[model samples]
Target: MAMAITCMLRHAVTTSCYENPANGSTSYFKTLTPVYYPPNGDCSDFYVPISIDYEQPEFNPKFKWTDSFGLQSFMAALTARASAPVPEQAPFVNAKQFKGDYEIAASFCTPRKPNGNEKKVIVATHGIGPGRTHWNSPFKPEEFNFVQYALSKGYSVFFYDRLGCGASSKADGFELSLETAKAVLKTLVKSVKEGKYTGKIKAEKVALLSFSFGSFTTHKAISEEPDLADAIILTGFSNNITGINGNGLLRSFVPRIANIENSARFGDRDDGYLAWPSVFDLIMNYFKAPAFAPSTALFTQSAIETFTLSELLTFAAPANISAEKWDKPALHLTGELDYIVCDGQCKGIIETPAKEMYPNAKPLQVSIQPAASHHLNFATNATGAYGVITDFLDAN
Candidate 1:
């Protein structure tokens, strides 16, 4: 019965132009390729290509006003006030008050051999996917890796799973919202500040590097708690700004009144990136229905099915705010051909604001990786180190 239902559903739906082009309309569809996440876990975290080789000391230029290549990595990009890595790192508390079995991890890296007194800290937060282990190859421990790259430079590195994603326990999907994500990260930072589990940290002086969904949570933290990080680096992400009414996917199925009521909690509207493509068809199939008709979970059965690229436009522009509200140094990195966060969107959300915020700050230095997709920007022909990321961080 389930197979019959599934086949019937598949037949009823027609793939967009990419899948099945119309008689005269040009097809804009691209192949949907699955990304391979290495089982040894070396390909998960946002990483850089290792092909470009440069000595460590030579890479960290000593002079302030020297002409240098654009951002090497998000960390090395900063030249603000001699931001060095923290002295040491000890195991801190996990994100919750659980009483069961859990794994705890920690490590230290020095950008330059510490001068014994100068202390700096850089903490990396993972996206809404696998954990640290999956990012670094267990077999080739010393090969090109993000953790190893940072640790070699002296930045105290810390990363862990977010609840059920990795070795951690699992739970409902909606619990993975921006709020819950922020709370978990805040808890980790708090543990470091208080020296609760393993001592050794300068809580006041902290930096943040987050990618994808992690970027949203980090931005919310900075917006809510000004003291969390001295500076923030947001790569491959943009704010989810939605203000339009009654035009999202959910309206096609559920009553507009019902959707309006649920809008406050379930994001701006239904038919987000999750419900896209499928939900788009739903809206077109039942375009003439009264405003009160319920939608078919038809194609967008899961929350993941609620989103489409079209909806992203509604949230690309920055929200209005005073200059004083954002005083800290921020670095925004994006590839020119990013299929997910379109270059245009990045310009509107980050590039333009960065120019206004830090006028003297170099032109929103962008790394235009030709023919690169969203994920490939961070994880590409490089190994061990995130050259682009570290370069962006060094650009201050």
Candidate 2:
């Protein structure tokens, strides 16, 4: 018998009902409903066939198993060398076409009642592993939905999975790289501008919002296009990666094929996919003493998705962002306790690194969530993060 896998994006309603804590009755609230666009309509999810060619680093098989104790020790010695600032490398000149056209899956949501500016839209992208689901919490949709918050503030949101993860097309994970990711994002932004997705909405003023690995892709894409987005908001990200307890976090991911007992949760995921061990959820996602209920972390672990090797490599690569060319409004928000980006404290008199990276941006802001972690949107203080984002968007 085939294993049963839950599709997180199956809901199609524009509103969700939440039980009011004060009363026993339930209250209906507007939520981000699933909507289909051109090409693949209600019959299937939306997908775009994009052909792109870019030079990418050849994959080294040895890097995959380098997380062992001995290797970790060896890598530790080279940490300083690895962290040494290096000038960004230029895009590969010997670019080759990716094996086949990439089919990207996207989800779109609009405010229940448009406040009249349909052209103003925000394009959100998720990090590695999960798809757009990372932007909102499924278990407590009413309380922890970023997309719904943005919609409630009157901005339509367009979010999708990168080529190799989530419901998007699958291929040799090695084939998905930063160059390809940038190409995919460029296409999506252009499509939105052209009103290709839905004839009903045309984007005139656009903002780019991204998390973790998605932020890296967005940085490269916006750098290349320059004017693709009018404003940018980067979450679960920082210019520094050396501070992260990488080796510890890396050990938590075992090859998906090795987790057969939990096959149903992973579904038919292919090789090159990394599965998160439930036992390490606390160390990996939550703080020692979490602010939210323990149930929230459990739900997050159960809903965790698989990540691709290529996506990992893309993020592991040295930062080669051309921020000097970014002349729009930009915001960088991360968690105070973001173990992955910050060594646990993202606050204080820390400089706005992006200001130096994106010197030309009209105005740049940097902020840290008080008691949050790498997964800012899912953290207990997620509302604070949302406030920072929406406030930045409104000001810009």
Candidate 3:
């Protein structure tokens, strides 16, 4: 019966965004700002001072898949050599609470013309190996940028780099635990709600849009503070690990320092990061072809970001959270071919698990994008995923 219900939802609204284009009335500027916040409140009391880089844009950058023959060649050579055996990761080290000041990078986009009403803002958090760019593709923006699409629908979007990723403050790999992440997100939400961050546009309510590991952080945040967001969208996620193709996923990552000389794109990044040596491994484990352009794969490899050891250990830590306290609307969407989260098939099996996880959510919807993998936004059918998200937000 559960499988039957999931199948029905899958078939009812599986159209790609390309087939059904989005329409909107406003255009706005993409402005960058720095937001500084002090540690306070229960969630933030553990915080150090932090500066966040923010972006406000009316549209995404024009899509362009510029060739990087040299980078491509280097990647090919790295992939050819056998991957080194992954070393036993160091044990988790919890950062002392209230460790002074740090900085984070973030971006925001709003419609050009205000609708004369309280606006709804979506705060997005990216997964490991990608920062804000994960939400808005640098290459092929039109085809893969969810941020621009949300803007087209008159929705404001906020994206940020986690403490140890992208333009944010760098920390020892073990310093970025789940508890630290929850505090960071909680503080950001509070600042945004108070109009301290994006002052020009005060948000009536906020929604959370998270991908992969970001989804994990979101889960921890919302579980602790049930009213954190009016609505929540979880993508590239699942609570079940029994189905994951772990072996294939594990082999895809090489230590950042393992091939530091070849990774010119990362410059002098430290051991806290990991890199994907094989585009083939990425496609097989994270993306599905035909649904994702070849260039998307290459660009993903070239622009890969760091994934902290603290995050990995935190992810592996046991959790016994209950969603009975959550009462907001929630949605869980994943690619049908998500090898890591869903073992290449998310439909028919995700609904039950999601229900168990978000039991008290008013309307918890779970759907799978056909022909996509874990990285749905980069897939050819990304517009479909985007449409599903905006539609849910509109309905709620």
Candidate 4:
């Protein structure tokens, strides 16, 4: 399976979706309800694919070009600086071996003055791309600063780069597979569950904070390995289509005449960079004759580059693991103006789904930070509405 995972990308078309066993919702698969085609693909003889079935001009802001230039430019600067030289320090503990070709690297910071026992431990993971260690830019350091903040509060912090990312080694090309990714997470949880390293650090319970695609991957981890984390937070949730799953069919098969009207009214921004994830959604929306426009390609690319297409499929698929199965308390947060992830999509998947199944379970608190972009909202000690998130996490 491990070897197969590394090669899955070689043949993976564009995007893939999962079939919901419990519900008939083939969330990933379906034809445009406004129109239909025959099974043999012969209905195309008379059917024209150019009619715009629905229109939402306002959605343009959410999916427009240049909308996220400010944020992305800042990130780029940070990454460039972080690439500079830095002193190396020994890891607090040894890296743990996981499933085939995977390893979990952890860095620990014990409380300066232990009152009685070790302070609480929070395990964190960075979103896609790069390694566990962030670049030396202000924003990247901001992440380190947050971890340091936890330390100040007498909390030990453990973070690692996901496979094919920071610090961790990967095979050539490093194809992304949910099962392979989950295996590494499961291994980390198992080590914690069995108290392998509990003796060194008195970690009472592990708290996990994941953002963007990290949330999706983390959710899968918690679902498959119950003992992985005691508390979980998923930030920036959404449902978007991918390029591999029939999204490309529209661009390739649609009639040139019909595409004329729609292309002029709604289409991708050729001048800018459209991340892989957003490209998939745009293609899907364009095919369905719906407005799949995003504010900018950079924002979508941020998401697409954050996690591999295979990982996105896991997030979009019907969660086989239900809230009822999640024993630990979970908290949800989304940025109000987070066009890439979108607040509505986050609530739909995390908050709404949890409410339906676990009637008696603790309510999943959802917080929306006004005017906050995806990264800024999760920041610690942030001024204005962002402070509210810090306060909530602290109070909890």
Among all candidates shown, the one with the greatest lDDT: 3
Per-prediction TM-score to the true structure, in the order listed: 0.47, 0.77, 0.74, 0.51
> Model 1, range 1-396, lDDT digits (tens) per residue?
343344333422222101111122211111011111222222122111111111111111221121112211221323223345633221122243222222223323333443332234556665532243323322222332455555444454445454333333333222224444566667666665554322344544566776555655676666667677666766555432322121232233222211122332223333211222233443342221222122222211111112221122222322222223446666655433443455322334445544554344233343433333333212333231265555555454
- Flag the better candidate by lDDT, 2 or 4: 2
Per-residue lDDT of model 3, residues 1-396, tens digit only: 343344323421112111100121110101122111111100111122464322111111121112334334333443343564543222322324434257666766676644532279899988876666677554555667787677777787777877766566666443455556666788788878877556477898899999888887788788878888899998988866566544444445433331242343443344444455556756767787678777677666544566643465454232235567789999989898787777778777677767887788989988889989889888888889999999998888
**Candidate 4 on 128-205: residue-level lDDT in tens?**
432333211112223224443444445555555565442343322213445555555555545554544444565776
Error of 1 at 235 (Å): 0.9
Query: TM-score of the candidate numbered 3?
Result: 0.74
Give candidate 3 misplaced runs (Cα > 4 Å): 1-90, 93-100, 116-118, 245-248, 258-268, 316-320
lDDT of 4: 0.39
All candidates in order of lDDT, best leading: 3, 2, 4, 1
- RMSD each, Å: 20.4, 8.0, 13.6, 22.4
Task: Report model 1's TM-score to 2 decimal places.
Answer: 0.47
lDDT for 38 (candidate 2): 20
Q: Write the per-residue lDDT of candidate 2 for residues 57-89, one digit (tens) a residue.
A: 655444433233533433344233445564332
Off by more than 4 A, model 1: 1-118, 133-144, 197-204, 239-324, 343-350, 353-371, 376-378, 381-385, 391-396
Q: Which candidate has the top score in TM-score?
A: 2
Please give the distance, in angstroms, between residue 219's alpha carbon in candidate 1 and its true position after superposition.
1.2
- True-structure RMSD for candidate 3: 13.6
